[model samples]
Target: MENRLFYVMFCMILLLSLCSSENYFTKNVKGEGVLAKNSYVNHPPNPPIVEGPLVGLTRKAYQYNLTLIDPDNDLLIGYEIDFGDTIEGSSCCPIPSNTTLTLYHMWYNPGVYNVKARTKDGHGLWGNWSTPLTVTIMEGDTVPPVVHMLKPNKGLYLSNKRILPFPMNLVIGGITVEVEAVDEGSDVSRVEFYVQGSLKERDYTTPYSWDWYEKSLGRYVLTVKAYDFVGNQVSDEIIVWKFF
Candidate 1:
């Protein structure tokens, strides 16, 4: 009996040692589960909605992180962010308990992207990729006169001729742009132009005309804004570069 007791005690010690040790990775298993102390499951949290074409890079701390959520709470090794098309960001493991993903901008034209949080414990069980979160670049740019191109559409604006489709730079084609002006909350309306790129003009109204000049050539984009009688406003861009 004494020998049997000794054997049981030894086994208990061995099991305890294993439990106390940190867990490195838990593969295959997923969905609503717990991790042993020092253990990690997989991946990171989801991404948020972004606006604008490039959401201009900002110097802000937008911590987008997720929890490993393993009861063992093992010592995680590191992480990586893969934003499609070979775009990637990474960090060492044993991730900061309060770590978050930092981004230069929140907006993109239109597409899907994701982030990955890689964690490794002292164990060799490599965890699977984190839950992938997809995001669609915001498309809510309602500003009017939506300038469409960088180069003017035509060298000649002949009367009674359907103008060719104008395009915008730094953006994909098929975007809508318009111009209009009106009095404050009144029906009165009119349009004006202050050409500056290649032509010199101070103030003028719509249905304006200009002569093409060979001397004036290189780069030119038009910016126009329309206002309503009630003092409403809209803006757009136009590129001028069509030659006869």
Candidate 2:
């Protein structure tokens, strides 16, 4: 009876060890298997790239396109757009990778706005928001500023006729270059002057002119560019002959 009891006790101990080993092997299999399974599940899509016009007219509908890519080739489920005007929109449906989603929006007031977008994959995971795109809305200011050079008129003979002989080059000591810009829709914001392809002066107010004290010799190209409040720009250039 003592030997039989010992044998039964040994068999029970062996069965318990086998059960423990099986439990540990099952846990190891789950840890490795679940990693592979979860890799393809619930992965977020990549951030989207938005493309559209940076400037648009108020009350006019503007269309924008968003491009999305998924790392796991998961189908893009939807897109969300925030116009930064307290308004948001969403699009639903499965779209393939590299497919562009189109959306349209209109603003009633003229102002600057930032637009942002996000994309979701088929697993219902939302990615991070994309970089914002800035948009400026104007109130129908389409006409460019009218600009012209005022000083150093073309064909002006600077040299004194009595002192210099005929057919001599026009010699000038110094001259003040001026520009006049007019904008009917918006006020003139600034004017830029370029001499020989180099920017020389920038004027922000009226009576736009630069007093060039240095005497210039030979042919010089003077360019004046004017901009309005709405960023409409116009440039005018003139060829002037200077001799010292």
Candidate 3:
């Protein structure tokens, strides 16, 4: 009879232990915690191209491809980019109630700012202002300068000494020099020039005047390099003066 009574009490305690009576923030007896997903009471849309917080000149304009994620099949009603400060030509209007909106605006800012966006669903529920996209208006230089070598092959040249078996002691030649450069993405497509880096010649470009000069003193090497407006370079060399 006593054993039966003790068994009933143990069963009641075991039943109570199986039931947990705590909320999401509480840790269980085993030290493990159950957490909840972050609620998106207010999340903003992501724009293509320049990631949010873009900066531009006051007089200059830029375009943004704003994409709205539609959780429901409801119609998207309207959208706008709110420049915290006054922009030169900020415009806003009703959208086709579609999921995507493309926006173009010229901002004239005498100020620094935080810009946010807003849109409405067909169900009349206006979403929270998008995470603010800031635009800072400032001024600076934009022009890119030309590139050239101070000496040697402005980078272009190559030759075969083995072919010129008629080698000489007075042929004090065979030296190498380098050329380098950079450019803005626009302008003349490229730059190519020859180097007078050898005892073999004078002025390479003018072919008819094929004048090969004597190397009375020292060796020389010249190279010509090609460059694109975007600053990509390809360089090659010519051994103008190779003394064997």
The TM-score of predicted model 1 comes to 0.28
Residue-level lDDT of model 1, residues 1-244, one tens digit each, is 9999999999999878766778432444565445456543544322222222222122111244445433244444544445443444444545533334344333334455554444444343345566555644434322323112223344333332325553432222222222343333333233333234333332235433233333333344656544433333554455644332
Could you tell me the lDDT of residue 149 within candidate 2? 79
lDDT of 3 at 56: 68
Best of the candidates, TM-score = 2
Better of 1 and 2 by TM-score: 2
Summed backbone clashes in each candidate are: 43, 0, 23
Per-residue CA lDDT of model 3 for 65-112, tens digit only, reads 666554544446555556675432222443433345555655544467
Instruction: Say which prediction, candidate 1 or candidate 3, comes out ahead on TM-score.
Output: 3
RMSD of 3: 17.8
CA lDDT of each candidate? 0.40, 0.77, 0.46
Superposed by TM-score, candidate 1 places the C-alpha of residue 218 at a distance from the truth, in angstroms, of 30
